[model samples]
Target: MVEHQRRPGWAEVEDFLSATLVQGGTEMAAVIESIDAAGMPRIEVAPTAGKLLMLLVRIQGARRVLEIGTLAGFSTIWLARGMPDGGHVTTCEYLPEHAAVARRNLDVAGVGSMVDIRVGAALDTLPTLLGGEPYDFVFIDADKSNNVNYLKWALKLTRPGSVIVMDNVIWEGTILDPDADPDAGAIRAALEFMGASPLLDATAIQTAGSKGWDGFAIAVVRQGSATLGE
Candidate 1:
């Protein structure tokens, strides 16, 4: 296990900044506690990242959103909370138990009504999600092996001004090493895909906090590139 020494530098700064800027309500706190009680994997975005998602949604005036992962609904609640009234969030979860816990957690947070939980492998469920109104924002936090494909679906289901966010791409900087793990290779491949794709203007930001070192790839859709429109 990684040692939990008190980080006196950037990570500590992040924790302080998060506490100063992002305030979680009682319901939101319960959501986190419930996730722990249920013994779910602790892979959800950090509080700062969750706040960032909310801020991005509010900045973009996004009325509809798609999330590729729904682990205990932490990020899902954040996204839903950031939207205006009548806004909706669609989240995909492959594991039934995780989805069930997420559903309960979302309800406890009072954002369940704003979310549509799609239970299935995202690669399969994504294709069935066609013909709906395109999302104004898409967050890809699912399996990294299919990161490129997720971007393709995000593009297909978004229009100009839409934003795409991919999580955990940096993997503590392992992606830079040629002999890294498969997920690291996949992250590099996704970066290459973003570089070559004409439909998106993409960039990434490194992040650190309680979740350790990682980063997200963010993209904005190009005009007239979406094959389908809302």
Candidate 2:
């Protein structure tokens, strides 16, 4: 068996390809360009991932979605667009500035009403939000150190068969090393948790293209007897 050699900056390359493929689409392309102009941390999920997310939401017929990060609302727009007519996505951002920009982007995308931009630490906000109701899908793409915490919260609030997509799971090849960096350690822990969790059926895919050196882990909450999209 060949060793699983971790690629470098694969996630970034994937994002670039996503932007490239989605280019020329009037509204989505414009949003991608604006995000590029901002020069913010290039942590947003790739457009292909966004499309996959939308498809997952639509496949589950998700009416309520939760996103842990809302950077520029790029990924949020994709999620919102996938919603069945009245579906809504509640996304959280720790930085006020980022949240504000995301709000604006969502507004520009005409998905403001469907996408709620919450400004605060997702850790603090997730508990409170969970009290109200559960979400049909949850996407995690925030501080890598808190990924495990985010997954814990997501597991509690999502119903059976709900999809939970975690970005940057490979962490620029850091995760493959036995001696882990802080962020890599955290990502490893989350991956381990998902691997062992009885309630989740998870898989990680290695993607290569524009966004470089990374991959994502997608876990589906398993519902016994009852099928998804009931």
Candidate 3:
């Protein structure tokens, strides 16, 4: 395993960007507070990243969003807020306790009604959504080991032109050496799957922030693409 380096300025700039453009406001703050209160891992996306998710949802004109993680409902709030009046977000969380905290946070954020919190492994929960309307956007931010599995599910649950975003792809540059860790190996496999899949056009970007050096991959289902695992 390689040591990850962080410059003091990265987080400073992130805070500045959050205050200037992200402006998450009180609801986001309360979500963060709730996570702390529940002793949950503070692994929610950065404010800028959360805002980006919101913008992506809006830009995609997504009425239905599927999220593989619901940590304190921080990102879930952003995803829900981006949708139109009747938009819905379905999020899966493995831990019941984490889901409980997220439930309170989502309700407090005033977007609880727009969100469906599925408490279980995402692989199991995702299967239940198979026959529903296809999601317009999908966000995968859960356990790294199942990234490709989540991507496979995303392909199954989304239509052509639907967008999918996977977080923590860079993983402090550990992806350059998949043998570094189990998570790194899985991330590498997921990226490889995305790159080689004929049904998608995808790209990834590296980012530096309070979360250290990490990044995300974004992909769009190809027009006339055949749905996988049909």
Candidate 4:
């Protein structure tokens, strides 16, 4: 059953908006279907959220993007579409199966050439990324436990003015409750880290939509960004 089944009315509105406003959303629908058919978890970002990322890309005139999670590449496609003609997106995925599906999906959507998929435990992969000519935009949607670390790396790999967006920050409005979900611990920790950390000027935006009650956190690297208490 589609997640929209839980909130049919709002979901319908989102669907309508996608049909009318989201360019390339038709192909995005097919990408979701393909991901589902491959038996991957149905946890990709909502269509509206995907479009929002693309909007940010356009707003920033971002030429280089880094994505922490590449679930079937749905969001990757959207981010890739938002890039300038020579722009590129580098996304990391832990699961090889999911990476394969994402690759095919990107190809079908005709943006494969613009994306480079790095498959492995992100912890092992993130540290190896270069800091020279830092990325302009980054999206983190991988395991919540490592979000803090990912944010650390994001700060290291990006220069001032770069944008980093983290999904599921609200944990379905349970961010305040320590035991609300398994990820709550990490979510809470990451939020706290961002709050006092000098590296990012961040805020969490709660949202309820076809994907249910959740939200994303967006942070911009300030001048002289650093990790933790550095």
Candidate 5:
């Protein structure tokens, strides 16, 4: 993993943007506190990024969302809030303890009913989601080592025009050198898959903030992409 260096200016600008634009409010604050209280990792997306997820879901007109990670349900809350009434989200968490924490946070956020927290390795859980409705949006943010696996599953679970968002792509610029670390290598492989796949039109953006230098990649499944169980 790259050593995340937090320059003062990056954090300051992030705070300013989050306040002036994100405006996540007290509810969002409570969710953040819950993560701390549960001693969970504070690796949830920034407020601005959360808002971006919301906007992306809304823009996609997505009624079904598949999330490969549920870190205290922080990003899950954003995804849930973006959907129209009766929309649902299925999120996978690898740890039962984490899932419990996330359940509470989602309930407190008033979006619990819309979220299904499945506790298991995402690769194991993703296959179970098959034979269901095609997800309109997919978010992959769990273990970096399985990013390419998650991306493949996203393709199977979604239809053409569906959007997929993968977080922590930049990894403090380790992506440029695939040999930098295990995560760097895996992330680079995933990016290569995205770029070379005929099924996706994708791009990655680098960002710096309180989380330090990192980024996310967004892709839209192209028309006629092969979907499993089609």
Candidate 6:
């Protein structure tokens, strides 16, 4: 079953935090600078989303985490911070410059050892990762055009009960309309896949704020061999 909830914009909260907490943190400031230097879009997760991901990781006792996008390592820092003592996160970023910035940010965060930033197209990198092991949490935030493909690959690499969280699922409300463009269509297809998959119990929550009109789709893999949509 699929469920959803809409909340006040998250940007306001993020703005407030940016002004108060993150404003004077040298390391965080440096990370932001690195992101800016990379020229890649530095779209970090909303504060609430970051906290929620951390909580989910801890709750699931996740030892292995997979992230499809590492845009200057903001989300990577959050994920790494949530891991258990020996837990690790493997994140993929296609842009070399962006990956370098992310590496620097992660290093400054003091969680560098806990994160592995792989530089390559996620489509090519994900398959190679499959042979290594299963992940307890998979965060997808890469190219929207390949969301469906990513979901398929994620499903195969995650064990039952693993959580898969897709960022930008709403695509600024474009997916809500019948006249969605190509990117929105790709997101819609991913949503349909999640809604129809019997192997997952999923929900979509709409959020607003500094991040604009976007949202996340979270799917928890069900136990046993049941298919999705069953």
Report the C-alpha displacement of residue 128, candidate 6, in angstroms.
Answer: 0.8
lDDT of each: 0.88, 0.81, 0.95, 0.87, 0.93, 0.83
Model 2 CA lDDT for position 104: 79
TM-score of each: 0.92, 0.85, 0.96, 0.91, 0.94, 0.87
What are the clash counts of all predictions, listed in order? 0, 18, 0, 0, 0, 13
- Scored against the true structure, residue 131 in model 5 reaches a CA lDDT of 82
User: What is the TM-score of candidate 4?
Assistant: 0.91
Give the range of the ten consecutive residues with the poorest summed lDDT in model 6.
Answer: 221-230
lDDT by residue (tens digit), candidate 1, 1-230 = 99898758876787787679888677667777877898977888888899999999999999999999998998999999889999999999999999999999888888889999999999889888787888999999989999988888888888888999999988989889836698998899999998788888999999777778889999898877645333
Q: In model 4, which runs have C-alpha deviations exceeding 4 angstroms?
A: 1-8, 224-230
lDDT preference between candidates 2 and 6, better one: 6
Please say which candidate is ahead in lDDT: 1 or 5: 5
lDDT of 1 at 82: 89
- Model 3 misses residue 114 by how many Å? 0.4
Please give, for residues 1-230, the per-residue lDDT of candidate 4 as tens digits.
64654546767887787777875645788887887799888999988899999999999889999999998999999999999899999999999999999998899888999999999998888777764568999999999989889888888888888998999988766777878677988998999988988778999898777887889999998976553332
**Local error of candidate 3 at 193, Å?**
0.2
lDDT of 3 at 46: 97
Candidates in descending lDDT order:
3, 5, 1, 4, 6, 2
TM-score (C-alpha, index-matched) for candidate 5: 0.94
Q: lDDT of model 3 at residue 72? A: 86
Worst 10 residues of 5 by lDDT: 221-230
Model 5 over residues 1-230: C-alpha lDDT tens digits? Answer: 99999755988999999999999878789888988998989999999999999999999999999999898988999999999999999999999999998998889889999999989998889999888999999999999999999999999999999999999999989888878699999999999999998899999999999999999999999987776443
TM-score of 2: 0.85
